[model samples]
Target: MANENGEGEDIPVAANVLGTIGTILWCIQLVPQIWYNWRRKKTEGLPASMMLLWATCAVPLGIYLVLQNVNIPLQIQPQIFGALSYVTWGQILYYDHGYSRLKAIVVVLAASAISGGLEALFILTLRIPYRKGTTWPALFFGIIAAIMLTLGLIPPYFEIRKRHGRVIGINWFFLAIDTFGALFSLFSLAAQKSFDILGGVNYILVALLEFGIYGCHTVWRIRNRKLLREAKKSGRSVDELLEERELERQRQRELESSNGERFTGIDYDEEKSRPSTEAHSVDGGFVQEPAGWHRT
Candidate 1:
């Protein structure tokens, strides 16, 4: 769909280099997250929906790349990227959602197959129109891909909101990789001979949202550091401090409830029992776990 006579545009060298880096980053971005989930035996604050949405995104994106006949790495990226997303999503199911190992494998494999088939079908459907000098059809797929991609990043923000402005329960390394991938891909778009509005918008949305997450992380970390110092100064463990904070938050929640009712039920403040209910549980919980200073 490059010209009315049917030709492919030349991919500029800068674009090629940048696109390759972005492709590589995205292709393997989820590995760290998957490994983190496996090592922790929990998904924690990572949202399963984000992974699935990304996996779904690969379908339309694969079709767009196929029809556009882009660079080799770019052409292959959506496929591998989506497959890895599926595997990562499966990990969430197994570790976070309590799916059996066998079930997770089965689900991931099945979803991958269905997604691959759907992508192929769309490519076949659009290939003729694209060759006949129609660009909008292929462009439509790109737009859909972009929308799906942006949607995938939104779930984490909700998790952050639920945790009261904290971006918690995700691997910092994983988030860094994803944000860089989007940023590099954006630069790659700028390097192109002609900017793809759809693609540019996608990367922009991703970068902006991820940067916001980083901002939230920064603010949360700064405040958390102060709390850590106070905890240490008072000869109270971080867990105990967290317990008190959680109890206070619970009281706030009860106060904010629409029922206009509040109840006090804290058994700590001056002192608390080991493995207290208010203590952020390493053994009993990791969801939205506070990033307190490491004791060891």
Candidate 2:
């Protein structure tokens, strides 16, 4: 049966089913990351570049899907994906990079507008009949989009590697959904007898990278748990360990805050001449005498 667009290809029912599933997955894929960022009020290890590139690639990918006259579910997948990606990117800019709200909004909107304009131009140019029953221009854009999608994963891959595979600020649930969505999209393409080599490779790479990160997170968690157990055996409360970690982080933040200042105008010599406080060692290794108390 011909599609509404009069494209001669007969899309399979199974393809529509798989495509719908993939579309749903992709639609909600970034929600976890967005929610995580909101709850934590931080985007520490999330790669803004990854989100930006993926959002940009979606414009061409959406155009290609429309040109190919794929099912409506597949056609709209890239748009939703792109919208969520832009949101995620904005979060990174705002939280991690300290971008002002107005600045982040302007940047995201500008990028989105540029992408939409380019896609429109490409679609119009590609629809021109260059040969008998073949739209080489659409195919060209599709290939480029696929390559861009694959390349977008590079930033996150290095981020994970830099953390020695620890998940860090990444939302693992987002990765799982994204990987599954890519796999289902591949199946959809295969069902339609339109399996693209680049598309397949892109999905494979996404799944592999996500799984690698998952494995690394699992290992790190296991190791941390073992150390915690050891600490517990040494009569240390887990609460104490957590408190110590928090204190260390506080110290780091304080050090960063005090990096460029000299202690002002305090005359230590005159203060010492007036009175001296006795110092003593205590359980936590510090003690100080009360003000105006002299050692006798």
Give the C-alpha miss distance for residue 3 in model 2, angstroms. 15
lDDT of 2 by residue, 137-233 (tens): 6667677777777777778767767755556678878888888888887787778766656666767777776777778778866867965786779
Q: Once superposed on the true structure, which residue ranges of model 2 sit more than 4 Å away at CA? A: 1-7, 130-134, 190-194, 228-296
Q: lDDT scores for all predictions?
A: 0.78, 0.75
- The parts of candidate 1 lying over 4 Å away from their true place are 1-8, 230-240, 248-296
In model 2, what are the clashing residue pairs, if there are any? none
Residue 173, model 1: Cα distance from true site in angstroms? 1.7
Candidate maximizing lDDT: 1
Residue 67 displacement in candidate 2 (angstroms): 1.8
Pairs that clash in candidate 1: none
The TM-score of candidate 1 is 0.77
TM-score (C-alpha) between model 2 and the true structure: 0.71
Per-candidate RMSD, Å:
17.8, 12.2
